[model samples]
Target: MQASDRYRLSASATWVASVQMEPAIGAVAANLARSIELVEMAAAQGAQLVVLPELANTGYMFESREEAYALAEPVPEGRSSQAWIALAQRLGIYLVAGISERAGGRLYNSALVTGPDGYLGTYRKLHLWGDENLYFEAGDLGLQVFDTELGRIGVAICYDGWFPEVYRRLALRGADIVAVPTNWVPMPGQTRDGAVIAHALTMGGAHSNGLTVVCADRIGTERGQTFVGRSVIVNSQGWTAAGPASVDQEEVLLAPIDVKATRRARQLNDFNHLLRDRRPDIYDEQSGATAGLRQR
Candidate 1:
């Protein structure tokens, strides 16, 4: 059979899509509308799971804490989260998108997960980057894996990908796919020809932990801060399945993945299983020492 024919015959394959778009600063209504539109388009193309960029509803780069608070809302009950939930239910698909969350007077950079059944869960950003610390509280909920009909889903936003422990923790919790809602910025000393460091970091995390990673990043400039838009989807083997979209365009990339395959691949030829081979005792002691030093 031809490759296309074989693909057509695979009933177990699931299609995942990443949406890369430019969000207008403080334009919640318009941004939500555009995101819903793009998700609809992806669903029409057979995408069962869709991921949107970080701060997708509320653009990044807040000038002050007051401004950030003005844009934040309660999750699942928030307007943006409700709209995404409605869209997911209407389309019979799973959706993951970022939002500015306000809870008990504190604002967190967060991502929400919704599916055909309605609201699922939220992941607060654990690592704040640059000016983000000025406005948003660091994540308190820690890493979370949501169980859905599609598979076990995990969520991380932007800078969380920088820490391998985030991926390792999720993978250990049986996460088959990790959805990253990110607003990536150019790193210091980055060159045009060089590979996107964020993308490389994601692939390495996925490969090392035997997990599928889907990143959705935004494009264009917001409040003079430019975002790097190269939304990518990596299979469990750490290979690009969909895209590293253009640096400045609205695009959707779709790819078929088998979540179960990732579990099998973790065995890695018996000699060196991804999760089985461990020297965690030594690392844990070292980590404790480092933490103690930082406390001093």
Candidate 2:
């Protein structure tokens, strides 16, 4: 089948990468090394923007907060963050990789966005899942988008993908793409489309928000917790642009993402604009007057 025109023929598309891998518990150095190796592999494959899975530096499922604190390091200054930044600098590409962030007395789950020039910014996970709350404080940095030469890149981690508002806010703030660093667990049910139900959430977010999503998920069983890998890239129209990589294997998925195309797609037609047509005045979920939903 022929590909639909999502981008202008004249505009350059950036090749993006989603890397899925299993990280060992407490193997900080080794995990960072492996993550870098996977990123380098993606770089060699002509990927200009690469994303690694959540907690790629320190394994998820920490036994205690002390253990997590001991392993966590300050963002940008930490060895893991610095190493990823250095790799992006050396490869002359952009990267978003998850790390365990230590700031003063708190530890938060974070994704650091780095580019060829230097460190860009960090997006701390806004929504914590399962035992993450036990080891890390809820992210206070808010959902952040980094402006880069490739495009405006936003970030979200594992559980954050579950909230559609995360993507909506990013898109509202002018994000062209969202890099999801996730350690997705198996949902109870499967979808008819050959992907897990969790995959639907990411795709739905992309479609609804008009944001291209690059999700990097981890595989294998960790401390009795099993992760559903299937790393994927969803285009603005909610179609699978690249992978839903293997569920139990280390892998890299790459696809061309044109931000200009995404922007144009948000128009839908001459009379409608996806973001411009929003009725925030009618969506006062807090009051629950005209809206059926309530803010959590």
Residue 133 local lDDT, model 1? 95
User: Which residue pairs does candidate 2 place in steric collision?
Assistant: none
Tell me how candidate 1 scores on lDDT: 0.91
- Supply the TM-score for candidate 1: 0.94
lDDT top scorer: 1
Cα lDDT of model 2 by residue, 39-148, tens digit: 99888877889999999999998999999999999999999988988999999999999899999999999988899998999889989898888988999988788888
Which TM-score value belongs to model 2? 0.92
What are the lDDT scores of the predictions, listed in order? Answer: 0.91, 0.88
Off by over 4 Å in 2: 1-11, 190-194, 286-296
Each prediction's TM-score versus the true structure = 0.94, 0.92
